[model samples]
Target: MIRRRPPAPLQDAALVAVSLIDVSAHFDAGEPLRMACAVASAFSLLLRRRLPLLTFLLTLPTVLFSDAVIASLVALFTLASLSRHRTLLAVCAMAFTLSDMTSLPSPNLDLAQTATLITLGYTAATAAAPVFLGQLVQTRRDLSLRLAEISEVRDHEQLLTAQAVLAKERAQLAREMHDVVSHQVSLIAVRAGALQVGTADADAKEAAATIRRLSVQTLDELRHMVSVLRASGGRPTELTPQPSLADLQQLVSGSGIEAKLMTDLPHDLPPTLQRAVYRTVQEALTNVRKHAPGATASLHIRHEGDAVRVTVTNTAPTRPALPLPSAHHGLVGLRQRAALLGGTITSGPTPDGGYELCLELPAEGTA
Candidate 1:
């Protein structure tokens, strides 16, 4: 439960009212000096919040001659609550006691001793209670702050544990796909390639050749997915080498489509933008080979004002094609990559029985 702090002005007003009554009562009893001292001490409580130590010291001497004890008590409480140094408070307590007790005149032995004990007891009680209560309040606040920090740390640990478990399951699935499924697909491709070369009939050779090409493309995509899953953890995985714009020619060389590149791109591209450009071109050409086997394709990369633009366009297939295997999420992933870097990508059918893909990304430090 939260504790509400009392307002300072209200507390000060209450102290002043009580001290005024006490002063009036002493004045009616024919004690003019006591009345003056009481009024001064009462008004001093107004500065307790601002200057606690000074208020306490200034009001201490008035307690010996005046009946205005409320201001002195409140000052003591303010001093204890505001300051944390114990040695300074101890010195103030000693000074208050010595100043008050030394103001007395000579008297009888037994009476003096009794008065000494009572004064010492009241002074100790006045100082001890506030100091003890102040320390208690401070300790409770410290403990509450520490508990809040511990709860946040525990929640963060649980979240990390859940993510780690999910990543482990993904890695396991990727390994199974790579080791079992890819191996079978490779065997099928090998058989189909042999049949395409050795068969006598034209239709049989065409069907086998189509099967072989699709199988090889499927294997390449599957390998890429497995490598990505394996690299998801804290430690690095020795996956396939990353492709860059430097390998554009190698990528388009034997793709079985008429592909060309037009570029004025600089050699020093930021790593992330460079990788995104390479992957965009790779996936675009791969889609052309799958859906439009004999299409003429063109890739253009240009550095416009503060932006790098990439456009891929391909004409309609010139020959009958086989229905290739596809999950159709490549463009979706490419669009997401562009959006994450504050870029845009648009793709649609062109006016002349063709397809076009365009991407625009900032040339600055998007990573």
Candidate 2:
């Protein structure tokens, strides 16, 4: 029987130390032993990075030629444990088996027994080490990728939430501004027209008195709106009374739009749906006054089972359309209001050469 010869302890230790030193020095550009160290260092680096073929090829010759079996075993262990490719590890095991079977001097044991023992030992080490190590590394990499993706998604969600909060605050501020300014301006216009039309001193005095009364009312309303705005801070609240479908008739009548209202609204409709309908009509009337002065308008409201539909249509202006000097917030505000109630609003030129606004909102409980 052929007995395996264990490597000398000092020689085995020296080879391991040399291999480690070579790998460390590979990072240095000005090392004296750079050229000689390159051979071992390159293989060591490949093994660390789990490049199986390169590691196997570089270590194989050294293992087969050296008299020290311990050094050969160390190289094989490095290959099996570090490399990811199973085929390369198997090839290295086969090479080690061939080297041991052909080289070992056996007086009693046959060649087949030597080959079988070497194959069994090398195969066990190569299969067990590389597979376990590879799985551990892959698992770590997968976990890192998942963490990175989660962080990205969290960041995106936070950004969207911030944007939504900002938009809501802006809309609230705009609503406050419109409510305060529009009513005050209308009062001013009414009083100013009365003053312009008056002829006698007594009539002028009466007009001035009317102007004073209007101004006081405007100031009071503005104060109330500002107080409400301040009390809310930056948070969105439903504290303000939203206008409902009934308010649309008042808005149109006050605007001098010659509007006709048609409605079939259910008594049990949601406040949000009513608010969306009212805002849409109000915005459409405002647009008619600004963009098509002296034109007639019509408002149609219908509650059809699961949904509420609103349509506002206005005739084209006969005179030259004057450019509106103020900001166009009405339509945009109406759209936002509709969207908040899970509704849709559309405004554009009608096929009959007029402007039109159409809105739809889901009924209560249906949404």
Candidate 3:
């Protein structure tokens, strides 16, 4: 359970009212100067938040000339809370103690008396109280801010760990798809092709041809899937070490195809930006697999000015590419993500009988 503190204006008004009561209790009717000093000191507390030193100075006359001291204590506390200069706070505290102990008009200088010594101790204790409370408040606020920053960093690390795990799993899945699924589909297409050539009846010939075409199409889709799965964190071994293209050979070979990854990229890129690059590569690889069967692919990641550039290129297909239905939603999604992060994605066919895809992301990773 918690209780909210009163608004500042209301709290300030209450302090002022209390100071006035203290003043009226201490000052006599015939003494105009004493009454005026106490009245001015009480009003000065309104300025404590903005001009603490000036507020304390205005209240000091009351401490010296009259018994009213609430305004001066309040002002001192405000100064301590806002300012970090320990030397200044100590000086103000000493000034306040000396002012309260010395009775003016006819000063009480007989410190040898027990009453005088007790009064001195009492005034010193009163002045130290506000300074301690103000410092404690400041420390608590700073600690809270530090804790919030640490928590944010921890959340970000957790997200990266999750992505790493997903990448490793996808790599494993891609292996299964390439070795098992693709092999079965390839055999089906081969058998259907042989049947189409051997069949004599027109209806049988058309059916065999349709089966062969559908099998080949499915095989093309499987190749795309194998590439997407290889987008895993280049075989993330552990979080202790930075993962990039270090284990890339394993991923390229694991695809059960001829692929290579080359990077001169810095290891300290923002995790979000890195994730975006990984997604872009997934799409590029998928395009290569679907449209260019038997093509050799290469990826180059590097720094260019204030941004990161990742380019994927694949040699032309050994077999004739069969047309497949596509809305190109994956490429559109990548472009939209890049725009949000103040980056860009571009792709085209290469002059060397290959296709090239490039993604550029701001190194600062700001949107």
Candidate 4:
């Protein structure tokens, strides 16, 4: 950070030169000595950071002894810069005049000539210092303040750029989900509706019923995903139902994975929390469908004190394994949802040669 200080060396040198020239013109004799004393006094005032009071005291001795009119003028300027009250400057001026008058021998000259010259010298120095230094300080202060403001503006612009990039990525993910999952669910829904209208065989009717149920479940999941995207406007006034531990059986059956479910859950769970649990299970099963078709799966849901735990495991397919196209976005979304609800999820291949997913969520408000 920049700190405020007295004028730069070059500026101080220039001002000292001006002070010497103006003060020296007043003296009829000892011109060189008077000019030297004036410059010395100006240098002392400029060197001391705190209002030059000691410099003013030092200048007093020079002003008293020297016949140099310039030395007295420099002392008066130092006093004006150092003191706030005009009365103090006036008092110093009078004292310096008396000292100069006393130093001179009794001569043809009277008090009037000495007093008039002293008054003119003191007045000029006092008026000049403030006009010059006041403008300098004001300009420096304005420049410092402007630079600080510019730095803050640049920092804010960088923060805004980072936020814009994150928002663009989120929007792109939303569009892709809509295209993939929504399209698949819509096709399933249309096929089920047609089968309901035209199918007469018992097996055909049963197949249609299964398709309709899965289609509706998939539609509900899509709606929740969309709601999450839209919630960025603000907290949603109403949250869509989220699938939880209770929905594991239906999710497995609907996905055509031969599955078994074992659970020790309470009769009820908080809807918000249950949804997180359900989505974790749902995502795991969807991965199984895509990567391990014809594999058997097992889901376990257990309630421990203050938390509900879920684990889903699916065996690897017997057929030659195909490299499934990954949608890493689904896992990213699942992890985010779990974190928002104060939960955790883990997915990997199990030691027993099956894909496994484990999830845990707080049950504070859940039964």
Q: What tens digits encode model 1's per-residue C-alpha lDDT throughout 107-180? A: 22242577778877786776677667766776776788899999999999999998887676666556445434
Candidate 2 per-residue lDDT over residues 61-179, each given as its tens digit: 44333322333455555555455666866666667655544432332325367776776576456434645565576667678899999999999999988977766575476475665
Lowest-sum lDDT 10-residue window in model 4: 233-242
TM-score of 3: 0.59
Error of 3 at 333 (Å): 25
For model 4, the local distance difference test gives: 0.62
The better candidate by lDDT, 1 or 2, is 1
TM-score of each: 0.47, 0.50, 0.59, 0.45
Deviation in Å, model 1, residue 190 alpha carbon? 13
Highest lDDT: give the candidate number. 3
Worst 10 residues of 1 by lDDT: 233-242
TM-score of decoy 1: 0.47
Score candidate 2 by lDDT: 0.61
Instruction: Give the candidate number with the greatest TM-score.
Output: 3
Local error of candidate 4 at residue 6 (angstroms): 27
What is the lDDT for 264 in model 3?
76
Global local distance difference test of model 3: 0.76
Off by over 4 Å in 3: 219-367
C-alpha positional error of residue 87 in candidate 4 after TM-score superposition, expressed in Å? 20
Candidate 4 local Cα displacement, residue 105, angstroms: 18
